[model samples]
Target: MSDIDFVGLLSFVPAILRVTTPILLAALGVLISDRAGVLNIGVEGMMLSGAFVGVVASAATGSAAAGLIGAIIVGGLLGAVLAGAVHILKADLILSGIALNIAAAAGTTLLLFLMTGDKGMSGSLASQVLPKVTIPVIADIPLLGTLLSGHHILTYVAFLAVPGVGIFLTRTPLGLRLRAVGESPESAAIAGINVVRVQVMALIVSGAFVGTGGAFLSMGYVSWFSQDMSAGRGFIALAAEVMGHGSASGTMFASLLLGAAEAIAVALQGRGLPSELMQTVPYIVPVIALVVYARRRQRLLARA
Candidate 1:
């Protein structure tokens, strides 16, 4: 294409940031839970629940903050359910999480109908959501402003979560305990680390972030909450945790790669590039990353 199209590729930068926000946040959410040795398979459910709760609250009160609070609380509670079933009730985590996610999908949909008396809850301003925050100087800047300050507050939070999670995992005592629990639960238990408590706490934190990320889907990225709007992002976040090896920066990096692929798919869609491949791009990221990294590791081990 021409130089303008080349510049148009740069437009994907903002789109990347916007698209990456939810993934990054959800990835970070899984990072903590995974680090603490808890497999948070219910992230998808938590996010879907968050999206539903956030939109319903915002529609009722017309307040963004209220929606955020509602999402976090509901998300955390959903996470607690996951943690309780596995930790206290000694349930199979994978099965429990999958059940929760299935329940959340149907639960949120049912709630949407009950609240709005409509199936989709569209065509009404009451169901519309979160206010955008535009800083004066930041919004006035050139192209960068739209790419940066023009996004919702959740976008900034997703970016911040990288270092935030890093510090929490490295600099804090709780971080050490979480890691200890993850790396060696027996050792942590011997050391008097309350494994169950730590796992439940981590799940709560993870759910909070996941919920906030879902809120981004309903309130920040778009003004409407649709059925299964989270799509496969919650599972993608779990893959991100595996890909990142439990590091915050690594999680963000994984999220960015996925986000870039997704951005490309979106751009392709606007230009009517085959919808089949458009769907494929987003799904390809973890596969490619995992394969490449595995090969690299094998080579490094062979060299050593």
Candidate 2:
């Protein structure tokens, strides 16, 4: 019994990190946009588009670098379109987001047929997958080595982004301007921050990172594209952003926390539990969080 406990704990460590990456990356994306007072609803769509573009590019070029680059570019463009519709055209942000997600889903499906003659494009895309990188010396170290050095280059980038983003948002002038815009666009505009410009640019960056996150899944981790592969991760990211109260580091921590729950759920499936039941675990956390968050807010408001 003790041996089983040890092995289960061992398995959980890797699972936690692996699950954390996608949510963490997505949370950062949303954090950037929200900090500018624009809610980005197209994260899942952007991620899906990035996944398709990245996989297609990598398969065609036989280079993971090209794939990563392509995903960022495509995602940025999508964000720009979304921003234009919302900030410029005065379209409803939520509606625009939903439209983009629908477009991403259909566009990818069409491209799959045109590119590889497959409906899902899951097959051809999976053919050109990224290889795991093993650091020679670092990999030999104990727990630190495995957690820090065991993942793909993208995983390293995700971790690096945590502190970098935190510093960028807290210590930089740009960060100040972004926050000002989020707090009040009119005030930010008076301060010469160009609220629209800041929101658009920040959301574009958000899309790029989210795209890269999706690319990590398709090109870096699984190397396959599927319908709605993002699986509502965008929504979860938004929740994390709100829960973290607009701080980059705080949101990142929230993302990782939810990610850990997802990892355990996935592991539970492998233990011969009903896969559907295990899968429900990840989905349930967000619902539970929302209820708790609302209740807390109510209490605080009543006290006030």
Candidate 3:
């Protein structure tokens, strides 16, 4: 490719990363929960709640960091509630998750309306956004600088978390127990592992990760939160986790692929193409990828 063409192509890198950050973080969270056999289907709700909480907290405290913390804590509490519904109340896991999602949607909107007298958005709140980070030397480099430097702080955390999550799942003692529980709770229990405790912890940690992703949605790019601001990113993250085949690194790659699809769609807008059609690209990519992966897996299994 020509230099100009290459540079033009490279310009999309930042956008892709920006789009991928929240998905990657939430996908990692899903990975953790899935590894423990709980499979947090309420991730969507947790993310929405987190975004709402982050905005409200940041506005109240005038501190972005405080907002992020509040988001994580609320997310963890939601996870715990899910756990309680399943283990204590004997509710079905899937149904409980669905209820949580429903509740979050209505709760956030109601809370916003009560707080700001507006149900659609939070424009009146003086929320703080998370800062971007610039690597000093890297920022001065040629193409590498543009690719690596000057990203939202959460973007770095999301990428760094790939390796961090991998190590936690593969190298740590708790990781082993978590995976063992996922594989077979009966077998894990036979081995003296506390399956309930492990799964509870997994869901809580999963929610915290998801909450951080929500904070990015509100505080990373926009300084405010809106009704349904999560925009189904949590569901996309679930697809990423499924495509990752239960691996953190794989999940990261899946998130990047989905993010790229969305970024391309955004880039294509106002270029004379149908805006509605372009908006579907991100969702379509995941369905196609999942189908292809499923077919491949089936073929491999048949051959084996």
Which candidate leads the pack in lDDT?
3
Candidate 2, number of clashes: 0
lDDT of 3 by residue, 184-217 (tens): 9999999999999999999999999999999999
**Clashes within 3 Å, all models in order:** 0, 0, 0
lDDT of 2 by residue, 1-304 (tens): 6978966676567667777777778789889998888888899889888888888888889888888899999889988999999977999988999899888988888888887787764575763655566778888886656665667777778878989988888899998888889999998888888888899999899999888888877876577787677777777877887777777778877887788878888777889899999888777887788789889999999999
- Residue pairs that clash (backbone atoms under 3 angstroms), model 1: none
RMSD of each: 2.3, 2.0, 0.8
Clashing pairs in 3: none
Looking at model 3, residue 257 earns an lDDT score of 98
Ranking by TM-score: 3, 2, 1
Rank candidates by lDDT, best first.
Answer: 3, 1, 2
* lDDT of every model, 2 decimals: 0.85, 0.82, 0.94
Please give each candidate's TM-score: 0.91, 0.93, 0.98
Per-residue accuracy of model 1 over 28-145 as CA lDDT, tens digit each: 9889988888878999999998888888788788888888889999989988999989977999989999999999999888877776666564645244455656878977877667
Off by over 4 Å in 1: 1-6, 124-128, 135-139, 295-304
Q: How many backbone clashes does candidate 3 have?
A: 0
Winning model by TM-score: 3
